[model samples]
Target: MTFSKDEQPKNIPESNTTDNVAVPKNFLIPFLLLSLKQWNMHGYKLMQVLLDLGFTTIDSSNVYRTLRQLEKDHYIKSNWEQGEEGPAKRIYSITEEGEAFLKTCHSSFLQYQQMLQTFFSIYTNSLFPISNFTDKND
Candidate 1:
């Protein structure tokens, strides 16, 4: 059966829920704020960074929505700059509050990493039992 580019399989079911299925903005917001803390960037640049970080399925709308929410929360501030080729772009920068929040995020990330490492260590040890045999002469 030939299907057009926009067509989906017949067996697939569609949902009527209005809930957003995209990745939670909370996850990306901290990273966005952290990135902006390093340097100011517009939406496109932010999108590129997110893509480079392996977030290929992120929607542009979600990115903009997160940016707006961050701005509303006072975590980020934006300014408009006229570009030579196109319309003005809104550049975002992290605020002092954002920096503090990023610090907390960093700590949480480190703790998460440690927990994952511990889990892997236990799993590997259980999966492969290593034995150390002593010589009878010794």
Candidate 2:
């Protein structure tokens, strides 16, 4: 089935790549911290939990780097634990500071969520005609 441009619905937002939908930026922090808040885990387990949490385009290097930064900032703490069959693995857990930071993140993200909802509502609830678009010549 083909959709005609002229037949487009008024309330539908203009088409754009799905990539622009929700690009997670600075979200890796809360995700990692939040997980650690629940339980301690090794880097491997943390990475898997991030994948399970819907971070599809994440880089392993980036995750490790971020973890290092968080550790340096004293937001999180880590220690080595001997794995059953392999070498010791570094297990990470949220520090008191990390939990405090996570709470702040929750407040900030809640505001952002409201802003995003208001933004989408404009596209989904009302008609904004193409004719209203201002020309550069104006």
Q: For each candidate, what TM-score against the reference?
A: 0.73, 0.76
Q: Would you list the C-alpha lDDT of every candidate in the order shown?
A: 0.81, 0.86
Model 2 Cα lDDT, one tens digit per residue, 90-138: 9999999999999999999999999999988887555675667779698
Across residues 61-113, which tens digit of lDDT does each residue of candidate 1 receive? 98899899889999999999998998999999999988988999999989989
For residue 85, model 1's alpha carbon misses the true position, in angstroms, by: 1.1
Off by over 4 Å in 2: 1-22, 127-138
Worst 10 residues of 1 by lDDT: 12-21
Q: Pick out the ten consecutive residues of candidate 2 with the lowest summed lDDT.
A: 16-25
Steric clashes per prediction: 0, 0
Best by TM-score: 2
Candidate 1 off by > 4 Å: 1-25, 131-138
